[model samples]
Target: MITYSNLGKKGNLGNQLFQIASTIGIAEKNQQEYCFPFWEYSEYFEFQFKECSSVENWTSLREKAFNYYDWEVSHGNFDLNGWLQSERYFSQSINKNLFQFKSDFEIGLLDKYHYLFARKTILVTVRRGDFVNNPNYFQLSYKFYLTALLHQFNNLQEYNIIFTSDSISYCKKHFSFLPNVFFLENLKPIEQLCLGSKFDHYIVSNSTFSWWMAWLGEKKETKIIRPMKIFDGEYSKKNDESDYFPKRWIEHNENEFKLENRYWKLKVYGYFYALQSKIQYDLKRQKKIIKNKIKDIIGYK
Candidate 1:
């Protein structure tokens, strides 16, 4: 049997797929086999072996496969030259050679958390560096989300919100005021201990770091919420989908807490690390406009 782990962005889409794959036991068979598209137009996919003759079976089998699903705008046409080339390449190669268990065992693992949090509890996750210009955006979102969650889950008295990310220090600096949210400064160690458990409703930011939290917390019907828009521009507003969540699970957005448009324009340069391609696009458009103005001043060549 094969068990594979996710190496994608740590939020909703990644988390949902991870839960589906783990529950289905698709990653254990060929742990080493994996693939990710490098082209800007390519679709993303996750695959792992279900069974094999030996661990070395995939020595000759290439893991490359095409996936055409386009759920997020970020996955649309992008300039590969603008991406964090090194990190993108590295993330593509991430594959875990772990064991696969029956779906029953997977449910059992998730049950550990259910048993621990016997009382009603709300589990919220925040990703660090989601909004570089408005550092407080996620902080505010968490506050509003927590408030709404408490209101919805009337009996949810105990709140155990866990925050996990690459930059726990940064997240801590901004979100220290929350009353009872459990903040794990670093995620790697916690992942080893919990082995993916604990969490009820996952309030994920735009980052994929929280994907595993939602995936591993699926035993008790987890609700995963993410942003309708990651960047600021005309968002093409429409009806909110918070009402579409499962009864046992709910996905609500704190769009009311979204940062103002003025602040978003101020974010053109500082987000190179977070939204690299978009930054490059911004720079390119700026350069083109500059060139056109120069031509107007000096008379075109």
Candidate 2:
């Protein structure tokens, strides 16, 4: 069975995407042995690490499995691309397309149910890519976004901002502005039930879970807010829409927040990539230096 760990180095949602893609890919291969979640554990890696060591040998193997997303299937044990090219992956993509057809399917589902619901429905999603490699990065990051959003939309109404986050405990602890906002552990189940009805507007962090939710939501004229920059910096409306909004909703970056990697995984990866580039550059420089020294020593052109 194929298993994944810290998919994209993020939590549940990240892992879910990887699982969906991999499941489709493996199913295409007609290899019944290929199964996702051979074991289902809820705790994060650190929490689960000490308790579960039975599958320790599969760590490197799983990384090789996900590399197929980038088409780098050079892993000796398996042909990742071949698996992705299989019928299942393409079929899954097609299913998603059809599923998205609801965006144009008459009156929006949100209006149907949540239009006059006493509690205001605010779609909340958090992004912590910078914190994916860091510990509790999303925790701190979510608090920042949650507070900012509440303050920005303070006068909206007596609202209930239904938040979706991967970190349940963090949400429970930080977001206690009762009668105002609440947190849902994950949006996957919400996405399933909300085939028609969902949030009125989406206040999304730099996270893919919210991006897809807002995209899939059947709300017309929903206010979709995102961070000014993906992890940092800034972006134009077009880029933001293309990157975050999958449907006709407006994509606006109302806030700009710094990228915080509480665990420093992002920083670590950045340094890793930068170091690799510098090493290559230095190697070339050294080669040039050696060639010049040889020419000078031999007195040749």
Candidate 3:
């Protein structure tokens, strides 16, 4: 039997989908039964898989499982806690068979939003909350998304833009000004994912939630635009250079969008300019102090 863990985290839909997809892929490859015991939100979010008995402690189970199957199991650079990245093994066929709306309630909600999908629809997912508070996690700035939206509208004026986010307040505060931009509100996280999958095009943040939404989309012509840079700050070094994103999706380079906003340019260059001025001031002060000390020594001599 194959078993997986999320390292005891909760409420991260993207990470949870990655874990679930990876688990399903491993189980399919090895022809073994699998269980995802650590996911506490399984009741709320559902996947198409056989449910095995839940284990009490995932950490202990992970160690023992790896030890017993060391010969069969090899950890790769792409593996996240024994669960490999799904795209390595995941395909449209597997996704069609495995990931689906869990409940009749969600299905009803999907139908209610079905009319929106009748036209050329574009889904834009903006990730905030922890990502905003935590500087270490990479996030595409609002300006990057704004640039993408303008580019998309230029090419496809018919596409209706639907905005979804964990931070609805943040979305309204930032994205409300855009024409034809509709906010997805009052839906469960999984429900939101289901709704997003119905869209024809996607403008995604550097988020697994966005990744899965695009991945689960049924249209063959689905256009996915994602940020090339996945992590914020220096943490980019730790991630695999090649493995995170699918080859087919369009990658929006953050550096390309760096100069897109005059405000951002001023903020970045202004901060450095201020720092340079401070350094110069400190150096001049130190030089004057050293000069005074030398003069005092000469006078004493």
> For residues 202-291, could you state the per-residue lDDT of candidate 3 as single tens digits?
888878788889888846777888887566666656445366677888877545644345456544754565466457666776898999
What lDDT is obtained when candidate 3 is compared to the true structure? Answer: 0.64
What C-alpha lDDT values do all the predictions have? 0.40, 0.45, 0.64
Q: Between 1 and 3, whose TM-score is larger?
A: 3
What's the TM for model 2?
0.40
- Runs in model 3 lying further than 4 Å from the true structure: 5-11, 38-48, 54-71, 74-86, 91-93, 153-156, 254-301
Q: Could you tell me the TM-score of candidate 3? A: 0.70
Q: Kindly list the per-residue Cα lDDT of model 1 for residues 84-201, writing each as its tens digit.
A: 1011112222322122334454465556445435544444555544354342233333334444454445454366555565566644644455545555543343332243335566
TM-score, each model? 0.41, 0.40, 0.70
How high is the lDDT of residue 123 in model 1?
49
Across 66-132, the per-residue lDDT of candidate 2 in tens digits comes to: 1233322232222122112112243343344422323433235444434334665676665433344
**Stretches of candidate 1 exceeding 4 Å from the true structure:** 1-121, 130-152, 170-179, 189-196, 230-249, 257-301
The C-alpha RMSD in Å for every predicted model, in order, reads 12.8, 14.9, 10.5
